[model samples]
Target: MFGPEGPSLRELAVQALSSVERGYDLLAPKFDRTPFRTPDSVLESVAKALAPLGPFADGLDLCCGTGAGAQVLTGLCRHSVTGVDFSAGMLDVARHRVRPTGGPEVAWVRGDARALPLRAAFDLVVSFGAFGHFLPRELPGLFTEVHSVLRPGGRFAFPVLAPPRPTRTGYWMLLGFDTVMRVRNALWRPPFVMYYRAFRLGTVLDELERAGFGVGLHALPEFGRRDDGSPRARLVVARRTQPAAGNVNS
Candidate 1:
């Protein structure tokens, strides 16, 4: 699903061998041409869903690549928008892409997601197309980091697609991809951590709860429903817990 301007097969091979940051830096110029960038359609759907919740003061885009999610934050937030990622290359691209908007000021920080540097600073946090880089065991730490950055009553939002059922060919496709990734990582260096199957919804919700967020799912009916009428995708909204002593905002 790569565009004509995307990386060539040789470039892909070179990137696959380097570490994540360097690989992304080399790919930064061509990333949007690939299927990896979150589409504007998803961004529009999310913006519509979050708009009514509105008028947030600050927003954070976790693992924001090319600042696609940050653009959505511009609609929901009024004060400032920040995007943090460990990849310097990705951050560079993001900074450039969102530069001329001049509507909502943007900041790009280079840091690992597990130990984010902010403390209760953001009113809204969002991420897109980057979760697969994290392993299952890393979810708790990742969620904790996100929680630590959010102010009381602030939200962490992201979209999740429904898992494929046994009857679906998509199920087997994802299964095969994950299996190959496991095998590849077992033998490769500077392991690429993107896997289609590692982040299950139940486990993710449990981790968010443990990290002190009150969670809810907002079904995104745009993608339609399954045979049983379950939503094909949903936006997970987890609001940061206020102190047990009192309601900080009130």
Candidate 2:
């Protein structure tokens, strides 16, 4: 649900009809007011989860819309933080909005996540609420790109919520949303790809492993647990196990 400052229904309709980059560009000004932006609670929880594992340098926020995740990196990473996104408009908003004081230097880069412009340049990489833009088929390459940018033993971290069960109304709600998106993409040109159900934990872990990450899951206690006593949200920490063949440390 969007607030009064968020995009209007007509504005949202226009964005849905455009390409993902163009849509986000159009929505950039009001993205933080909308539910689409990653929540502060989630960011705080992720930061808490990552703290013990870090003291990192040179962090990157993959698909960093408006730099929320990059703001988290400023606290954890010591040297610098870079936010890379395909949307110029989002980067512009981030440039003005996400200036953290007296910590790591923050920079913004415009680049596609699938083919990142940097190599072995980051000690950590974090992404928040951007994976839905990538289709399931693209996961392998996406993970590979993340791995390629991270230095040896560096982490690619993000929080993932446990999928809602069929009995929950939230389950139907997400299913409906994904169905509508699929239909929209089917009928529209320059398809806007977003599917709530597409990113499965098992499949994603496999892809992360295949891309040379030694993956681990950390339970986020802030979100509590499910009825089955499993964690409701988890931080997926995928560490790059080795350096690329010829990557010079940056």
Q: Each prediction's Cα lDDT score?
A: 0.86, 0.92
lDDT of 1: 0.86
lDDT of 2: 0.92
Q: Candidate 2 — which residues are off by over 4 angstroms?
A: 243-250
How well is each residue in 1-250 modelled by candidate 1, as lDDT tens digits?
Answer: 6667889989988887777777888998899899778878888888888888877999999998788998789878888999988888888888888873656678988888989977778999999988888989999889888887888899999999899998999999889988987887789898877798888999999988888889999998788998898999899999987532223342
Per-candidate TM-score against the hidden true structure:
0.94, 0.96
TM-score of 1: 0.94
Report residue 227 deviation for candidate 1 (angstroms).
Answer: 0.7
Of candidate 1, the 10-residue stretch with the lowest lDDT total is 241-250
